[model samples]
Target: MKVLQNYIKATNTHNFEEVRKSLHPNAVYFFSDQTCTTHEEIQAYFENGWSIVQEESYQAKNVNWLYSGSDSATCTYTYFYEGYIDGKTISGRGRATNIFVKESDEWLLIHEHLSPLPK
Candidate 1:
């Protein structure tokens, strides 16, 4: 849970380096539009989003931990994001699932999948 919180905080920083610290070396991310299997790709995707959504803020709500063990954990949550795009404030909500694994006593995000809520 702490790792997830830290990851969200890192994302809010809008600094790829900070976000990278929370991700596993072989992390995979499934976004609404694309999938990133490598850290380089993930960083690019994040940076592009940050550029498009200026002053973006993201948060997770109603987090439910599906499983948790000494080595791994999985959770699902409703995610909300708000920011200025094209000088207009915009916001959206979606669903997210995250998988984390403990390595060297540190929890690192191994996988994440995000999708928009139903119309």
Candidate 2:
């Protein structure tokens, strides 16, 4: 869905309102070092740590919509990403699974789990 692309771009660019547009009110986001399950928690995560990321890109590989119902969809994909952190360029790839729920006919991310592939 286009929303997915918007979500990625918004997060990479640290566009607060744009990113929030794609997330559910109670969406849950999982990070390598922490988890966010509430609006406040997620917002804080983005405002604090996520905002520090200056350049980031997330590309989906072998993406599959495992289940697509009238109101929900489950997607599994490999996310290849690279970015700069504190002036040092770093890169990593990971697997991403997410649940998108339709609200008023628009899909919003309800749950997301992302983990890096082993070295």
Candidate 3:
């Protein structure tokens, strides 16, 4: 969906405000190490990640929409990320699930869960 694409673009910008524009007010995020249920927590988590991973670029691959309705949609994808961490180049792939809902005639990301891919 366009919203999902926009969200990914926003993330690449590494600007929290731009990213926040794509999220629902009450959005929740599940990361490999922690869960964020509040906007403040989510913002902190994203900022911290960006700080650690300089010039990080993230992408979603093989996205499959598990469910799509008039008001809501859910999708799963392989997420790839690469960047420099502590002056060393690092890259990884993970599994991601995102849930979005239509609100005020626009789609907003409500929930996202990301986990490390299995060996």
The model with the greatest lDDT is: 1
The prediction achieving the highest TM-score against the true structure is 1
| Model 1 residue 26 lDDT score | 93
What C-alpha lDDT values do all the predictions have? 0.97, 0.81, 0.95
Please list the residue runs of candidate 1 whose C-alpha ends up more than 4 Å from where it truly belongs after superposition: none
Candidate 3 structure quality by residue, lDDT tens digits, 47-80: 9999999999999999999999999999999999
Expressed as tens digits, the lDDT of each residue in 1-119 for candidate 1 is: 79899999999999999999999999999999999999999999999999999999999999999999999999999999999999999999999999999999999999999999878
- What is the clash count of model 1? 0
* Candidate 1 lDDT (Cα, 0 to 1): 0.97
Candidate 2: segments with Cα more than 4 A from true spot: none
Q: Candidate 1 or 2, higher lDDT?
A: 1
Error of 3 at 1 (Å): 1.3
Which 10-residue span in candidate 2 carries the lowest summed lDDT? Answer: 49-58
lDDT of predicted model 2: 0.81
lDDT (10s digit) by residue, model 2, range 58-117 = 677787889988899888888877777889877777989989999998899999898887
TM-score of 1: 0.98
